[model samples]
Target: MFDILVIGSINADLVFISDIRPKAGETVMGKDFKVLPGGKGANQAIAAARLGKKVGFIGCVGNDDNGKKLIENLRGNNVETQYIQIVDDVPTGVANIVVAEEDNSIIVIPGANYSISKDMIDKNMDILLNSKLILLQNEIPMEVIEHIIDLCFGKDIKVILNPAPAVKLKESIVNKIDYLTPNEHECKIAFGNPNTDGLLTKYPNKLIVTVGDKGVLYHDGNKKVNIPAFKVDVVDTTGAGDSFNGAFAVAIVEGNSLYESLLFANKAAAISVTKIGAQEGMPYLEDLKGL
Candidate 1:
């Protein structure tokens, strides 16, 4: 049985690093270029596995070299990849990323990620139900996410929804989620505004809004608390949120309270930004020492 099951997209990140972002219609040279394995789904799965959780991933990747490498990467991180499928016809998902002055902008080509279907979810129904918690993101199709949510509702399995690349969610679906983690921008898009009062009134303590550097604010039904981010020299902010979500799932599934989980996740994210690449920056359980 898995500690946390993540169902989302998988992609290869083509990253370009430079000192400054190029202006519109202008061409600029980058200092370095690399291709890294990434996807909201894969990143979170690896992040949790790195923290010693038995994480399983369910997603679609193209039947290609990138797919093989990504599978190897996940297996190397100790995540169960049995549920991952290699779809023919479609190419692997890819993200064209540019990092300038430590900030990044990305253009994602969904490719095989969009191939996630209802049949895939149904096929993995048993595996999905056997997990303690299910982690979801906006990378895959909404129908697939909704299907998974329907399966887990009232089944005693907890659900954590990280609405990245935010989309408007039905209240019926929102009410059923045990946790909702969204970054500042995502929160704004989902709710029209990121006013804490309005969001707290609606989501209560279930909402977690991650404000980069400023830290995270959470309302757990009782009260709202702002958990300050751990201070660190940031190298890349790409996978920081994914790291937080992954580590947070680990803590919650391990029976830690929400407050404690947030603190632990906060530290994990802080450590991630000090390194390069998304998965490369993730910290194991041993790395969470006196922050």
Candidate 2:
């Protein structure tokens, strides 16, 4: 059985480096362009796999060269991609990433990712129910996420969701997630009311709020605390959060204390930002040992 199961979109990322983001209707010559195998789900899967988790991926890719390469890349990282379905109708997902100095902006074309049906989630429900942990991101259809959450109910498995690219999930599903990781923007988007607001207060289980640079905030019932980020010279920080979430799951599954897991995750993410590419920048166990 997989230690962790991930269900979300899959894509190849086209990353470009520019002195600054080009203004709308203005074209600036980019300094460099680099292509990398990435997708929020793919990145997280590799992140966890690199941290020694038996991670299985459930998503779709195109039947084209990109799809074949995408599967090969995941397998190269030891992330199980046998369940990655290839469809001819829609091309593989693609993320157009532009790095403006230290910051970056992205525009994604879901392609085959959008066709990952609810039925697929139902069929793979067993994988998630049996997993020690399941990581989720908003790259897939909401129904897919909902089905997985519903099926994992009362099971031994834990669900760790990073509500990225920010979308509010159905309240019922929110109540079911074992853990929720939302960045500052996502945190604000999940809750609008100041009285009964705060994603932590709304959820019955664990919730973690990640603030870039300032660090992460972990809240479980009456307990809440902050975990500071490791100091590093950041380059392109596209997949730092994905790395952190994946590493967090690995540390937790390995029986590390929550604080320790988060600290380790923080370091892993810090290391990721210092380099370029998503999975390419991800550090291995020995690399973290040096930190």
Cα deviation at 54, candidate 2, in Å, is 0.9
Best by the lDDT measure: 1
TM-scores for the candidates: 0.97, 0.94
- Look at candidate 2 and tell me the lDDT of residue 2: 91
lDDT of 2 by residue, 214-284 (tens): 88887556656778888788898999998999999898889887778889998889889988888788878
User: The CA-based lDDT of model 1 is what?
Assistant: 0.90
lDDT of 2 at 45: 91
The whole-model lDDT of each prediction reads 0.90, 0.84
Collision count for each candidate, in order: 3, 0
- Candidate maximizing TM-score: 1
List candidate 2 stretches off by more than 4 Å: 193-198, 201-205, 220-223
